[model samples]
Target: VVDFAKFKNLIGAGFINAQRGLDDSTHAEKDILGKILGKLFRSGNTDAAPSEMKESTLALKQVVDGMQKTVDTDFRTGVAKLLPGLKIFGYPGISDSELSTETTLNVGTILESHTRIRYDQGDGLFLPETYNGLGSRNLIYMLFQLYEFFRDWQSRLIENGIYLIFIEEPEAHLHPQMQQVFIKRINEIVDQFSTTLNVGKPWPVQFVITTHSTHIANETEFESIRYFLTEKNQQRTTRIKDLRKEFRASDLEIDKQFLHKYLTLTKCDLFFCDKAVLIEGPTERILMPNLIEKVDKNLTEELKLKGQFISVVEVGGAYMHHFYKFLDFLELRTLVITDLDSTALESGKYPACEVSKGTHT
Candidate 1:
């Protein structure tokens, strides 16, 4: 859930507390923010003054103090009187003598209730996040969350720790170009944090992003991708295919580079498809879907390809062989449709000819 209300706690003591093995319902006295404020106002530090605290912290304290005063004077008096009248049945009358007014400031509550995400619409004009498009809001939310994570890590609340962040389908509300941009820039954001901290090799953060966007996948490095496959068995177990090892052999260097470049350039979504159709050129690429529909019409429902996910790639006959090993690696059922440009050698050159007259194919 992308609830802005919970964002504060997620990025604040709530996250740090969880890392410290503390319960979610931890008292404010034990909270990180509360502890910091308590240290500043302790008996020995009485002369520290509110000026020593951050402006926001002092403001929060003032608001909470005013609310506490109001509750004690107006609300608690009525509750105290009502407590004496509750001497019902055989139970002893409720005692209000020991009751004392206490107020606790919840950072999450303040942020959720008081914070407003406003956008500068124009000169002296502003609009709330609610008025913005969902895509824009989502993008802003994700980037802010990333920054919060970096800040939390930099706080060093937990020593010798690493953050395993799982960003699922970040492309949800993003356009193709935005998705590509996100893929390209996400690492830069993390890298900047690492540089600031002067972190050594294997920085204390790892991101596992699962995306269905071809643009994102295309922008990402081939070695970083992991394809999840569900086995077609009774148990239906899941398997992971590490693309880094797919063509790692020295002999397959050219094939690996070619596959990477081809997929990146074309933005082919073969990684997410159930079936693939490798065609000769633009002609077959354009007509393959309709051709499949026509063929499907003649087949039984069980054998039809009407509802199956299929990807078509325009790999010309001369280059189609490049994907042979790659497609086999994916275990994808594929159909190769190519034109046989039959020719015969006459003198020193091979000329196009009919199949019957062609000496070479």
Candidate 2:
């Protein structure tokens, strides 16, 4: 069991690394799937035939199923709590218009196993717990359950009283087609279930997303798109919206530029500026040193004790979290002052600035 766990752990870790480095042609560990197959064969625990290999894979799956059964009590409970209204298709008296109070769920690999789906007792979707048993179902099957659960529940939520749907990282572990389908389903639910807005009536049910996927970004309405840039050491963020430019690619060509833009956005968030001042807007930024001069003729003088020259930078929005570390890396002390009215308040208060990088001049 310990050896199996080690093997599984190594295989899982390799998959994560492989996904991240898929774009690099020079990366040596490119064929992670091939490596996994080789490792399984080299273990020599199973017999040396193709049929034996298949049986070994099934045995591994069974072990997984046994482990999941032990943990699924908590997993099942958590899933239930998240779902309040669920009108399953098979249940009697479950009409389309009325909200459902109960659901039946099964979690496992229904696709791979010819096993019939018999439920214990519940009131939601089926999330199979085992399939053809090597220990349980593969991770991919588990993900599919989540996808089905969310998709159906979201459809109902929109039908009821959805004003806006905010999705973060919806593209995680999903293909581009699945991402597009998810969005299309959401739109369909909105049209099917929402109340039509009268001339001055507000539109009910809008969608807002913060995503890292280029495919998802491209599929969305161009007008709704916003891009943010961050400088790591300087601790700066710039938000741009309603861009007069559009970058698109045809099916024949890969959108490397769009992908590069996404990478650059992430890179800026790690920027390193030695000593920086964070300003709310363009004009006030220009006058920070002078304003500080007027407010405390000794502010810059005091800052000099930190041993660094300061540059006042204007970030489009207040995203100090992304830029602060970069500024500190460049040995800079940051003094950030922004007008609250111009920007939406972020979820949390500004973190205390770290000034360790710069020495007192």
Candidate 3:
């Protein structure tokens, strides 16, 4: 769980550093905001003052000054009177030296503690983000993180480096439609930011999204998907099957296009499942679950399919062969259920007939 206010404060700190023309390497070592405020009030250095000051910064300075005044009048005076009587191991303490306190404002701390994300309800009323739905919160947080990464790129925090962002299971809280929309729109959002904020140079960022949602996988381009398969060996090593290269190696453009369109339209879960059943029609697909259950009930517990993840696909007899290469590439245990259409040749013409009466199959 990310503290949204703290993330915003970090972004604010980055912006302040950029505004001050401070070197990026020294950001961790220096308190840029504190130094700016010290120059403005304590040193009275007009030349060092920033051209613009935010209202938040002004309020923070006032709070720091009020705290300093309270410490000076109340805490310091009280401690001074008590110092004469204070003794350590029967040795009397001297009260000749006065104790002084210095107060420094930390903008990050103040803003993080005070800031809250609120949604504007009608009539100027606002509701806190905590009141929003979990799905919305998750989506908002993900987008904000992306924005922060984009800002980092725009600020040139790490020059000449590629920003590789790995978004693990972004579809966790999102609905199927929203998951599809997110996969479709994420790259567009990054490209838009790069073009608008980064001038001519593109944001050197690449996204590697890992998702179990069929909606997200369907929405993603075929070339971008990599299927990971765990081998049934002692070590159980994982193998990555790059869809683009696999399809390209076959040199079947029509088959590749057909498979891509078929998966996109059907939103098949074949990619995530352990085993698959390729059926000839809707009837077989509809009855697959019951068929598996019946078979599982009669088999031994170890051999039963009750706990196995199996995906049933209705590809029709004419198109079932098209998926053979894909299923083979995945190394999935597949059961193809297609009708064996028997035919009879008469005068060089083959016509369909019953299996018992037909000569060829």
Candidate 4:
């Protein structure tokens, strides 16, 4: 086991890093199915299982432990627990050995595993299959699991000198409102292990995240953010840390509060996209992707923009001022895709700002 005590002397922050991935490109890592199939045929570890648990097995343990703590312990959402049952195939299970309440789980005896999760989903408890049958909220469940899993996983890795974890789009398949909360809570995992292997000292685990989520970005330190400004074939990185250093030299003031507010209000996902298309009205929001895909090679060719283009659609011309601050700061090449006539809003019931949208903000 790696000792985190010496690690603290080298760094300041705690070990946990919850890197958010809000785009499709991030989904490559999220392909759990392909990953599972991948491990079956790989030629690396022989007999292969070492005396110690495999990396994947260790990851699964942290994930299970994390999920148990986050879900099963919280009263607001009720306690969600993960129960790993032994695969009773050719070998016999301990089903008849003891009372359900009295038996202790010994993981070594288990072959494959089946998981049971607890929540009030109409019925008393549900299986992964049960939730999948519902045909909704599957993505949300997975994201929550991933969040808790990595939150715990990072602390475990901190025993070593330094472990760098790269997090991609964390906001994929999550409801918009939950996006804000998810980003905010991910960092708390650091505090959970604030003094690991040391008294009053902190262990810093590096987490590098590339995100398209403004929500996640808002929760982070501005100095940590680096924007990719892509125009034509030229791309340059704008580091907020460097910007602050330069602005201080030039005696210029940047309104950071405006940046935070704009990000919070719009919750725009713009950090890692090639470009952005600003728009208003549902018609433009609904239609622009198809229209742009025909012309913009980046939207179709890039792995990040598989389903959607790199864009942010404003409510309309009326609210352009709200987003201007953010647009100006990033200096991103933003394409304004508007109806221009303004008749669309006048003809119909204006897009209700009070929309439930999804879960919570």
Q: Write out the backbone clash pairs for model 3.
A: none
Best by lDDT: 3
**By summed lDDT, which 10 consecutive residues of candidate 4 come out lowest?**
36-45
Q: Tens-digit lDDT track for model 3 on 123-166?
A: 99998655666567567666766765565444432343566777
lDDT of 1 by residue, 174-239 (tens): 788888888898888777756754343334666778777888887777689898888999999989
The per-candidate count of clashes, in order, stands at: 0, 53, 0, 10
For model 4 the TM-score comes to 0.42
Alpha-carbon RMSD of each model: 9.3, 25.0, 10.4, 17.3
Candidate 3 to truth, TM: 0.71
Question: Model 4 off-target regions past 4 Å?
Answer: 1-112, 118-158, 195-201, 229-231, 234-250, 268-331, 334-361
What ordering of candidates by TM-score runs from best to worst? 1, 3, 4, 2
What tens-digit string does per-residue lDDT give for candidate 2 at 113-226?
324333244786554323223112222332333333222223231222333344555655566666656655655544543233122332244556666665566555434556
Query: What's model 4's lDDT at 24?
Result: 39
| Tens digits of per-residue lDDT for model 4, 319-356 | 56555545666666788765534222324444433334
Which regions of candidate 1 deviate over 4 angstroms?
Answer: 1-105, 195-203, 354-357
Indicate the worst ten consecutive residues by lDDT in candidate 3: 13-22
Off by over 4 Å in 3: 1-104, 340-361
lDDT of 3 at 99: 46
TM-score of 2: 0.26
